[model samples]
Target: MIKHTPKQQELQNLQQHLLTTLHRLCPVSNGAAPPPPGEWPTTRQLAESNDITIYQARNLLLNLAGRGKVLVTPGPVNKSLRWYPSL
Candidate 1:
């Protein structure tokens, strides 16, 4: 079995929580068809789901995206970000 440091474990927990939140927010999961690329939960909404601050949620999102567990794309308008679950 693999072992994890306390920080690593904590980060893993955060990643799982974020993924669950994204799944819950997915359009298809809401009894709708799949959404366009820009349809995703806002950073604020995600933060609220996880009970974390926006800045902290942003950092966690970036970290997850870097690891390919999540996907980050440009919004429909500005260069702002849109977050999605990659799993």
Candidate 2:
């Protein structure tokens, strides 16, 4: 069997909490198709869903992406971006 250090276990727990929070904060819409699992949300979408200002959402998403907890995709229009949790 494999073993995990305390820190690794804690990290895993934190990731799980984050995932749960993300889902609760941004549930898939009724009768609307959902993205594949682990796919990130667009910056605009995230902002609207979380009810935060676009600037704050962008910064949060970028920080999550940098930590490897989330992935980011450039928006089709202009240079905006989207974010998803890393699978």
Candidate 3:
């Protein structure tokens, strides 16, 4: 079986918590899902809304994207990345 270091486990826990919080705060929790091709908020906005650091938000979203739980798209102009839940 695969093994996870202590830090890895801690990060995983944090990611789960963040995702749970996101689901609760967003429309996804109320059966009013976000638009399929709607615009997603920036990492900074997510961080602010979730009361977490930008780095933490970015890490959590990136982890979700890596797992195919979310979608990551390149932003126009500045070329930054934006994330959306896979709902």
Candidate 4:
């Protein structure tokens, strides 16, 4: 089983909340699906939108990507990432 720290749990909660918010805020043709791959927001944008540190945002997304909750892709440059919800 996976044990998460208190802070990690908090972030996980935030990530779920973010998904709900994103689902509402993100423009999608299909009401039930996440945005297209091209429309996936950058990690920086996700952090800025949620007022969280990039480290926190990236780690959360990384965890999700690992678990197949989201689709992650490398950005055009180093130290950058893009993600779209798969949940």
Off by over 4 Å in 2: 1-40, 74-79
Q: Model 1, 20-70: lDDT tens per residue?
A: 898788734544544666666778779889998888788989998888877
RMSD of each: 3.4, 7.5, 3.7, 3.8
Which ten residues in a row are the worst by lDDT in model 1? Answer: 27-36
lDDT of 3 at 33: 60
TM for candidate 3 is: 0.62
Alpha-carbon runs more than 4 Å astray in model 1? 27-34, 75-80
The models' CA-based lDDT, in order, is: 0.77, 0.60, 0.69, 0.72
Judge candidate 2 at residue 87 and give its lDDT.
53
Tens-place lDDT digits, model 2, residues 20-60: 55666556576565564345455666667656677866666
After superposition, the stretches of candidate 3 with alpha carbons farther than 4 Å from their true spots are: 29-33, 36-41, 48-51, 76-82
Per-residue lDDT of candidate 4, residues 11-63 (tens digit): 77988865665555554565566545566777788888888888888888788
- lDDT tens per residue, model 3, 1-87: 989999999788777766666555454545566653335556776787767898888888888988988766655324445566667
